[model samples]
Structures are given as structure tokens and as C-alpha cells.
Target chain A: EDKVVQSPLSLVVHEGDTVTLNCSYEVTNFRSLLWYKQEKKAPTFLFMLTSSGIEKKSGRLSSILDKKELSSILNITATQTGDSAIYLCAHQETSGSRLTFGEGTQLTVNP
Target chain B: AAGVIQSPRHLIKEKRETATLKCYPIPRHDTVYWYQQGPGQDPQFLISFYEKMQSDKGSIPDRFSAQQFSDYHSELNMSSLELGDSALYFCASSRSGNIQYFGAGTRLSVL
Candidate 1:
């Protein structure tokens, strides 16, 4: 079975702190990995990483995929309360566009 | 900029009732995907359509069925509703081999 697992299931941090969320996967015919931030109703696209060692960034958020290790990490710098939400990681296999998602990491940034 | 659209932001149905949820893919998008997310759980893939044809399926229940129209819109028809079926149903659209943009999701509550 294709599976994606995320670590630090829940985290609490003060504003301005930095935090890292982890995702590891085991699947066949790996194609790409993606990250999303789900707030209340919908999950907004964050980044898509396909190559190892290449980092994708958006403002204070960044992510990288390590294919050799079958894992990925999402880093948030200068975190703020606005960054508190469930961070989801998913991967697509070459067979199709379907995504297998992780349990997600719930982050809470307090002021 | 257009994004995936889902209708009936919320639906309430009694056990054994039937419900139909709709989805309108983004302009020029040729694929649509359906996912169900229960409280505190990751999104689970239900099914997907490519160019109005069933392309892939996942852990969808036997009581559920879905189809895409030529207009690139889709609908998920769920019958014999169970309490476990209550969840957020999300519709996502994407161009072939690209990132998917999700809808705000329809909250289904089975009483």
C-alpha cells in the first residue's frame, strides 16, 4: 500500500520561532511531492518538489524533497500566528495524477 | 484567475438518503478529482475523471458513484448515507500532469 506519514503530529511554538515539519513516503513509481496549507475549509497549494536537493520557497516558507531518503521537509522561518494550520504532504505516482496524502502536521504559532 | 468550484457548500441528509455534490473545474482544466476528508483525518481519494472519462479510483464506498461531463464539470452521487459518510468533500481540478487547485469543499452532515 502507498503510504505517507508526517511527523510531529502537533506542534506549538511562539511567534518568531522557526519550525520544521517532516513527511516520509513509501510508494511505487514515485513521480513528485507536494505541500499544502489547509486552514479551515480548503487546502491552498504551497509548493511542489520533484527533484532531490532542490528547494522550493514562497516567502517565509520553504520545502525540499530528498528522493534518496524517500522523505521531505517543510520549514517555516519567522513564524507568525497566521502560519498556524494543518500542513499536508502528498505525493503522486507515475501511474496517475492521484495523490496519497499524509496524516498532516498541525502547527500552532502563538503570539 | 479561475479555480475549482464545488456546490452546495453544506448538505444535511438522514441515514439511507441520497445526495449529489457538484464540481466545476477551472477553465481549460481537463481533469477533476474528488476527495473526502473526515474530521482530523487526511483527505482520502475517491475518484477522478480525465476528459469526462473515469481514469482512476481509490477507497470510494460501493454506494457512491461519480461522473464528469463534457463541460468539464463533475458530480458525486452518494446513496445509502451512513454516519461515517459525513465529511468534507473536496473537488480539485488540474491540467494534465500539473498541480491541482481545490475547491472550498462541501460539508456533508449525515444525521
Candidate 2:
């Protein structure tokens, strides 16, 4: 069965700290891995990683995929209170766009 | 244009009643998917319509059904609402090769 698992389901950190959230997926014909951050009603897209050894970055947030290991990691630097949200990782198969998502990691950045 | 739109931002219904949730996919997209998210849980796939056809369904119960119109607008029908069915329902639309855009979900409470 295809599955995605995220570790450290909940985390609390002080502002300016760097945190790493992990996601490992076992999918068939994996096409890409994507990340999302959800704070309110809708979840916003973050990054899509389709290759290993390459990192996708947006400001203080970046993610890398390890296709060899069938895993990915999202790193947030200089975390702020506004970044306190659920970070989700999903795997997309090549055949279809239906995404399989992991149980998100709830991050609390305290000031 | 609006990305994705959903109706009844919140709904409260009594047990044994029926509820209808609506979704208008992104104007240019051809696929619509429904997901349910309980408090502090990952969004679970329910059903999807793509290319004006019923694509697939997840592990949702039989009481839940979905339909898609020729215009790609979709509706999710839940019969005999149960307290366990209370959660936030989200509508998402995506083009064949694009990332999904989600609507502000409707929070349903079964009393």
C-alpha cells in the first residue's frame, strides 16, 4: 500500500530556531513530492520536489527529496510565530494527480 | 477569477439528517476532489471527479456519495449524518498537470 508518514507529529520551538520536519513515502511510480503549510481554512502550496540532490527553496523555507531513500525533509530557518502551522507532505504518482498526504507535523513557534 | 469556491462555510445538522455540500472547481480545471479533515488530523481523500467522470474514491463510508456535472461543478452528499462525521470538508480543483487549489472548507457539526 502507498503511504506517507511524518515524524514528530507535534513540535514546539522558540522563535529564530531552525527546525526540520521529516516525511517518508512509499509510493508506486512516484512522480513528485510536494509540501504545504496550513494555518487557516485553506492550505497553501509550498514546494514541489521531483528530483533528488536538488533543493527547492523559498526565502527561509527549503525542501529536498531523496528518491533513493524514498523520503524528503523540509527545513524552516528563523522560524516566526506566523510560521506556526501544520506542515504537510504529499506524494504524487505519475499516473494520476491524486495526492497521498502524510499526517502533518504541527509546529508551534513561540516568541 | 476565484480559485475554488465552496458553499456553507459552516453547517450544523442533527443526527439522521442529510447534508449537501457544494463545490465549484477552478474555472479552468477539469478535476475536482473532496477531502475531509478532522480536528488536528490530515485531510483524507473522499471522492474525485475528473474529465466529467467519476475518477476514484478513498476509504470513505458508503453513506457518502459524489456527483459531477458537465460543467465540472460537484456535490458531495452525506446521508444519515452521524456525530463521527463532523469535520471540515474541503473542495479542491486542479488541472491535469497543475497543483490543486483549495477552497475555504465548510466546518460541519453533527449534533
Candidate 3:
């Protein structure tokens, strides 16, 4: 079975702080990893990493994948209240292209 | 861009009743997926539909089913509702191997 585990299920930090959320997975036929931010409603896609050691970044948020370690990390720097949301990591397998998601890490950026 | 669109933003149902949710994928997208999310929990994949066919089904009961209409619209149906079926149902669409875009979601409350 494909499974994803996320650490530090919840966190609280002041604005301008940096945060790193971790996700580890055990899946068959690994193809890619995805990160999403869930705010008021649906989750918004953040990044998708297919290869190892390559970093994807969008402004204050960045993510990297380590295939050997079977893990990925999402980093947020100089956070603001607007950046507060549940960060979800999902892994997709090639055999079925099915996504198995982690429990997610909740981030709260206080002003 | 117009993101994925879902219908019945809010639904209230009693046990033994049936509930149906609808979704319209983003223009030009070819894949559609469905997920359920409870409070404080990550979105759970229910199914994925591609090219008018069901691609995957998750750990959901047989009461839950989905159908895709020509890769543009999809519908999720629950034959019989249970208390545990209460959750926000999300619809997502993806291009050819691209990141998914989500809908605002349909909040289903089983009473």
C-alpha cells in the first residue's frame, strides 16, 4: 500500500519566520511528488517534483525531493499570515497514477 | 484561469438518503479526480477518471461511485448515505500529466 507520513502535524510561528515541512513516503512505481496549500476551500497546487535534487520555488516557498531517501521537504521563508494553511504532500505512482496523501502539516503564521 | 467547478456548495442529508455532487473540469483538461475532506484532515482521494473511464477507486464503500462525461464533467453519487459520509467533496482536473486545479468543493453534511 502507498503511504505518506508528515511530521510536525501542526505549528505556530510569527510573521517573518521560516518553516520547513517534511513528508516521507513508501510507494510502488514512484513517479512524482506534489505539494499543495489548502486555505479556505480547495487546495491549490504548489509544486511538482519528478526528479531528485532539483528544487522548485515560487517566491517564499520552495521544495525539493530526495529520491534515495524517499522523502521531500517544503520550505517557506519570511512567512506572513497569508501563508498560513495546511500543507499537504502527495505521491503519485506510475503504475496507476494514483496519489496517496499524507496527514498534512498545519501552519499558522500569526501577525 | 477558471478553475475546476463543483455544484451544490452545501448539502444537508439524512441517513439512507442519496446525495449527488457535480463537477466541471477546467477547459482543455483531460483528467478528473474526486476527493473527500473532513475537518482538520487532509483530502482523501476517492477516485480518478480519465478519458470517460474510471481510472482508480480508493478505500471507499461501494455506495460511492463516480462517472466522467467526456473528460469535461464528472459526478459523484452515494447510493445510501451514512453519518460517516459527511465531508467536503472536492473535484479536481488536470491536463496531460500536469498539475491539478481544484474546485471550491461541495460541503456534504449527513445528519
Evaluate all candidate structures by whole-model CA lDDT and list the values in order.
Answer: 0.93, 0.89, 0.88
Residue A26, candidate 2: alpha-carbon lDDT: 82
User: In model 1, which regions exceed 4 Å deviation?
Assistant: none
Pick by DockQ: 1 or 2, better one: 1
The candidate with the higher TM-score, 1 or 2, is 1
Q: Candidate 2 on B1-111: residue-level lDDT in tens?
A: 677999989999999999999999888798998999998888988888888788878877899888999888999999999999999999889888578778988899999
Report lDDT (Cα) of residue A19, candidate 3: 94
Kindly report the fnat of each predicted structure, to 2 decimals. Answer: 0.72, 0.41, 0.67
Candidate with best lDDT: 1
How would the candidate models be sorted by lDDT, starting from the highest? 1, 2, 3
**Model 1, A27-55: lDDT tens per residue?**
87788888999999789999998855699
Q: Look at candidate 2 and tell me the lDDT of residue B39.
A: 85
Query: What is the per-residue lDDT of model 3 for residues B1-111, given as tens digits with 9 covering 90 to 100?
Result: 788889999999999999999999999888898989988788888998888888878876899888998646999999789999999999888877568778999999999
lDDT string, candidate 3, A47-103, tens digits: 998866799999999999998899999999999999999999998776235567899
Tens-place lDDT digits, model 2, residues A1-111: 789999889999999999999999987678888899999878878998886568999999999998788899999999999999999998878534677889999999999
Give the range of the ten consecutive residues with the poorest summed lDDT in model 2 chain A.
A90-99
Root-mean-square deviation per candidate = 1.0, 1.5, 1.4
Chain B alone vs. reference chain B, TM-score for every model: 0.98, 0.96, 0.96
Q: Name the lDDT of candidate 1.
A: 0.93
Q: What is the lDDT of candidate 2?
A: 0.89
